[model samples]
Target: MPPRDPSALVAEMSRAEKLSLVRGTADPAERATGYLPGIERLDVPPLRLVDGPLGVRAEGERATAFPATLATAAAFDPALAREQGAAMGREAVAHDQHVLLAPGVNVVRVPHCGRNFEYLSEDPVLSGTVGAALVDGIQSEDVIATVKHYVANNQETSRTQVSAAVDERALREVYLPPFRAAVAAGVGSVMTAYNRVNGTYMSDHADLVGGVLKDEWGFDGYVVSDWYGLATTVGAATAGLDLEMPGVPAPGAEDHEGEWPDGIPDAGHAGLFGDPLAAAIDDGRVPSERLDEMARRVLGQMARIGLLDGRERTGELDSQRHRDLAERVAGRGTVLLENDGVLPLADDADVALLGPHVHEAKLGGGGSSETTPFHSVAPDEGLRARADGTVTTARGVPPVPSRSLFDRLPYLDWGRDDEESDRPEPSLDDAVDAAADADVAVVLVRDATTEAEDRDSLALPGRQDELVRAVAAANDRTVVVLRTGGPVETPWRDDVAAVVEQWYPGQADGDALAAVCYGDRDPGGRLPVTFAPADTYPASDARQFPGVDGTAHYDEGVFVGYRHFDAAGLDPTYPFGHGHSYADFAYGGVTADGTDRVTVPVENTSDRPGREVVQAYVEPPTVEGVDRPDRVFAGASPVELAAGERREVTVSLDDLAVRRYDPDGGWTVDAGTYGIAVGRSARDDRASVAVDR
Candidate 1:
């Protein structure tokens, strides 16, 4: 094959060549392979790609592993996520991959969302910030990073057909921000979602793909279809979806064996080279210039990434640095949701671990987000290694249907011989009785695995809530550690002596959890989403969620999570940005320069070293036609402080800082005095200052 200009090659190619260019070829070793018979004459070697947002996931070959997206968000360190991306990019280059289909930026809206492990957090700002950083890191290593599931792909169940009927405000505020941020960060490619936004499929949605992504956001990258996500090649191609992944074979071609036949369709059916492109050209559905432009963009990305410069390597696939990053991210992403001085157990303290989650640690979720971890560490093993006393782990409660009060009652036996209403009487008495002899009981609670995304309700699943309540009733010094990807309703928040939320920390997650509890490390992570009571949920009415017509309407608008709870004047079980540390910290003397700077002194008041994330929120006085949250997170800074150490942190605010997206359209700053509050969590405030905009 000659080294031809990508544009010239695209222009000179027949229908078959164009089809082959977009479809991914299968690995030689795989029995099931996709063969593109249309472009045999092009004589171009097909580029091999694989599934991944974290690492290359081609079977039969080992690849470097990185922490899951959720784990990276827990780090609260953009630099670290970016470094992980760079490592993944190097691995991609080593594998001779043209694109890395990853950096899943979908927001973690609900706890039971099956794909939550693959995503970052419920907060758009957090997800976007980390996603942008990762994109920068991946591209830096001279490999293309594909930011994916373009819009409103929070859940996995019925994802292909589900219609995300979100309001404009919610769409802009929650669902779309991450992609916008990723585009701004210069990701090389964007993959459209499998579901529909409103009523239009993402691949064929002109407004989303062409209008918002390409025009408004100024994204110059190529758009690819999620595998088999495109209904028709013409519709997708015309809608700015540049590639049809896993190319369909032509009709009657004996050499090819797979889905999509070989041979051009009859004149009426619009053959690959015939009608769609030709008709598209005639009706102005697609201009030749658009095709030329797409080819240029692809070629340009290749050149900029040094893919055309022969800089790719095969040895960079699994480096030590990549493995180290995976461990670091996994360690940092673990969150200590609650603790009452019981944590960081003394080396000599006797510990009793309980719960099914202890032995079967759910690291990451199912589907595209799943990664073959380099190694997995069980919490029981991790804790046993450091404990001086015998670490006795008891299966307190068997795997039951209910994890919380909100789960469907009268558990149906779907996997049983008969569909009997055999609801196992909520029993924690036996588990509590067993814990009577132990000094400290560590109860582990596991969330649902890959079956569904987002919870039917805010409550925890199964009788786990009942179990927690009973165990807490029996044992006063009980600690509950929740292993879930998203926020679960915690009615038993006040009962448990201590709590820790490990958001599906990938692979080495068990070790990270054990390390935090054993004082091997301090917990510095915070919640990315607000945990509201079931009654206070925006879609509190059962009929309001998932809608009647199979379309979920985002009636909450600009107010989501803490935004909705705060605006509605409702209290949450745990507010966003809420996380506790073993040591105490104080915020004093917060002053914002009338212009663009705010300086505050953060003092570690406790007698121990710890890290504190200082959050700044702005509350604009009521304004007409503004559906803005009273308190919006404007700035956040993480500080490491020693005992009694005071550090002065300065935060800058500009026009964008106080600006809110007007309900009508565009962004506008209200001409009123705004309240600037500094806090450890959304509900927990320390000091307030007035700022005039």
Candidate 2:
């Protein structure tokens, strides 16, 4: 039989069995990260969820670690994003995980957020475009794709308690678009954020989860709470949160100090979903029909992912093909922020690789996104293989110790044993000595930010600024390779000869870095988020950032990221979509096909084949009863062309791009001429065209 209707299956299930299906399993073996016990009587198999907005988070399973989602967004290619998801999905299947909690669609509201590396971009259009593609790719491979941290889960500090007091218009335009895109892409699950929204916890929000998502948007997928994110049982079920994760870790004695003891939480407790939920159901507080709906959604997804049919596959896990995909993402995502004609290191040039990260791959940021790759390519190893010149190495600074809980876990430390853990921190004199004689000095710097915490400042952490300045002083040709999760202010930016933002490149970090540094590949990425001074960011207000009295007021409204800086008539250190290319390109003409379609001619003026991201931004005019950002990222398209190649890049704007949302009314388009700029980055507008609606 071709699997009975999920509705009929739920109808056949007893109330207790249905209740079990809605919550995480209590069995030790089944509950790693995601789990649900199946009734043997009903022939339902346990569903397994795995962590991966980067890659599989299985402790011992050596899966492929691709670049962070931010990196994929930097590529500005939804097709590449799809490939990234497909690769991760294949790896998830190999690990026997039905649901891959991935493609975190949370908008990068503030640069200080520790988890921004895992997110896509500040622009809702860009984030949604890439996120939707990722969802489609993962689901194509019979894996359940979860678009997570639903609505305004921006900052990590006080994340569990802070209420994001956002207006309805900002929520619709800025934060919620990515999740809407994910739902439109047919994602199987949506994970509620830890924080509350407008004084209501997302897990218990009736208007959002029940009214908007379930009814208004017609999202049929189940809603799962973040680990330990379930606040109340009756409220959650009635509000449409289908699953409570890890079941409120054993109450009496704190079994372990960290979140995941032994790389997996002991899920043997049923604190919230057991007696509390059963009593609520028995007393008729939560309707039985609602329980049946939850069971149906879960079973429906299980059927969709082929979990009920015992889905199995082989030969796709950790394959060479997957590695190539990872390298491509890393290479393309590497943004050349600044250059002074010193890059594309000559084969004969002598190089001094100075920094702690040069010999180690800062594969991904700390937290749930961290993964132990099957094999990680160190920067030194990659440089040695690619460079024909003499390559000397030095640890310029002490390794930034792990403040992240995931980095301290024993399982992640398994493959890190071979690294120089106890090596003495090299003095500044030692680093200067190494760089003094080299033709070029490449310094790899990083930031130690993780989930549940935010960076203290945008400045490079510790004595890294001093280290970079000293090295740059010693050698005029100093190149700084930043492996950070998000934007960091560069105090020594002028001192360095060149700067590259690699955004925590994955397992093939070494190979990817080498390819971009040595001219084997061009830095094809543009900034998805703005690199601004710490004080200039709109969220710089003390009350806005870490929040005041456990509430983050979105007082700046829709002016976020580049939009904020633009509205303030201020310039950023590096504007959103800003990146330098080795090859030059000239813009020719701009034309509008329709209200939504735009075409711009771009011709590569350089001899080398290069990739270009043509960005389309709209300057919406002020209208009655509406608010608009100075400029909004309407649409963007990535194109690869050979030397002297000419092409017309066309970008089509969706309804969300040109429309403004109102509380009393739905999305409305203004009846005026909108100025469209075709450019390389948000700051580099080459051509402009106006179209009257």
How much lDDT does each candidate structure score? Answer: 0.68, 0.85
**Collision pairs in model 2:** none
lDDT (10s digit) by residue, model 2, range 1-693: 366679888878888898888877544554247678788998898888888889888645778888888999999999989988988888887877778899898999899998898999999999999999999999889988989998799988877778999998899999989999999999999999989999988989988898888898999899998887887888899998988885556443254444444223333334577678888988999887888888899999998877676655442688998999999999999999999999989988899999866778878877888887888899999999999888999887777765564454433442344355767767678788989989999999988778777888898887888889999999999999998989999988999899999998999999999999999999999999999899999989878987898899999888889999988999899999999888999998899975588888899999998888899888887886555787888888888889999998898876676889877888888888888888989889989898888
User: Candidate 1's error at 41, in angstroms?
Assistant: 9.0
lDDT score for residue 448 of model 1: 57
Lowest summed lDDT across 10 adjacent residues in model 2 is found at 261-270
Please give each candidate's TM-score: 0.85, 0.95
**lDDT string, candidate 1, 546-635, tens digits:** 455667666666666787788788887778888887778988888988635667899999988887878777777788755678777666
